[model samples]
Target: MRKIIFICMVAATLFACKSASSTASTSTEATTLSTKLDRPTQVAIKGNWVLTNVTYPGSDYIKVNSFDLADSKCFIGSSWNFISNNNKGTMTLNSASCTAFTSPIVWSINNQGLFVLKIVNPGTKSKNVKEGYLLKVAGLTDTSFQLIDNINVGGQVKDVTYQFQRAN
Candidate 1:
């Protein structure tokens, strides 16, 4: 009986220490998903960056509402600041042709290499923002990175890529 109890305890401890990526969900809502920070990625992406480009299969023809905040074109010159220490940041839209916008954001890069972001309104708190976005982080380097989001186009799925470069 003593041996059996010890084995059970060891098993329980290991099970409880399981990584989140082993059971990560597909939910887009930040609050419902595991936003575990990838320390290496966190350190690499900490700084100000600009959305250099936004592209997809038919990007020229269709307009996508990126992050449900602004048109995809509006993000071309947008600025993003990621503070990895606390996983907080801000995204500012700089398109003079589109609606001017900026907002505080809470963000994290999960173990699954997903960038989870919640955009908080100017006067509203981030915790109250129920909706959020999850984008796959790809080709991340000290100077550049890309966030890839999938959207349904004409009943088919396509990837929308947002390229970012370190701001001078």
Candidate 2:
């Protein structure tokens, strides 16, 4: 009788532990799915965008220029700009003629519906220009974004705002 009772007690304890473990595992799986379903989709800027406005410190200007984005490449007029990862390669401005310039920029988006572009100047061993640029997307639509360029000029900060409407 004593041996039978001891065996029953051990079996009951094992069953209880298994039940608790299964419940915990099930809840954890549900939580994982819930979190994944709640996550927002990432945004990618691709297609044609038009320039609408430019706001500067003392003046505001409207841009008649438009651009297109494909893959990681951006085409402005005749100029082509390529962005890979966080590195910006040399771009050629070819509205009519080709002019080459290099700008180091890091692009990111925030939860506050803002597309931020940070420009960093990586100096070469012989030449270096340490300048920074900040561009904020003020208003954004499915195919458009209003770009506000805040520049530091002559120790004073200025703003150049432009509207970009996606074309493609």
Candidate with best lDDT? 1
TM-score of each: 0.80, 0.39
The lDDT per prediction is: 0.82, 0.37
Q: Candidate 2 overall Cα lDDT vs. reference?
A: 0.37
- Model 1 scores a C-alpha lDDT of 0.82
> In order, what is each prediction's RMSD in angstroms?
4.7, 16.4
Error of 1 at 50 (Å): 0.6
What is candidate 2's lDDT per residue for 63-132, written digit by digit as tens? Answer: 2221121211122332212243432423233333323334434433434433433334455421132222
Clashes of 1: 0
Candidate 1 weakest lDDT stretch, 10 residues: 22-31
Mark the regions of model 2 whose C-alpha exceeds 4 Å error after superposition. Answer: 1-44, 48-53, 57-92, 97-106, 118-132, 152-157
Q: What's model 1's lDDT at 165? A: 99
